[model samples]
Target: MNKPPRKKNPTFGIAVFIVVAVLLVIATLFYNAIKEKREFDSQNPDTQSISSDAASTAAAKPASGAAQ
Candidate 1:
């Protein structure tokens, strides 16, 4: 008696592996860009939040000693 050979599936192959790798790289780049933007915004304060009195006092610190 003779034996028969086994058949392979067409759907399971290397094409799927390459697609997954490309998606992972794009996600990492976007994450790093957003993190840096948050840090930059935190370092700078909004002008509207500071009161008029405090703003004037800060501007006069150097002139106060010289005029008197």
Candidate 2:
């Protein structure tokens, strides 16, 4: 009986492996990002300070055209 032909090159298998690895990396990064966001929202004081500082700066700024 005749045997079926075997794949001559390994490039296809390597390409598929690389693609899957990249996708897994991307998914991990996105998951970490979401987790960090949730943690930040739960209450770190640094975030509060930043927001307060921004509000203070906004309040201190002069209104447009008032100096003219």
In terms of lDDT, the best-performing candidate is: 2
Candidate 1 lDDT at 19 equals 79
By TM-score, the best candidate is 2
Off by over 4 Å in 1: 1-12, 46-68
- Residue-level lDDT tens digits of model 1 in 1-68: 78787686656656677778888888999999999877867886453345876888888788656865
> Native-vs-model 2 lDDT?
0.88
Off by over 4 Å in 2: 1-4, 44-68
Q: Residue by residue across 1-65, what tens digits does model 2's lDDT show?
A: 99999867799889999999999999999999999988888866456566888989989998797
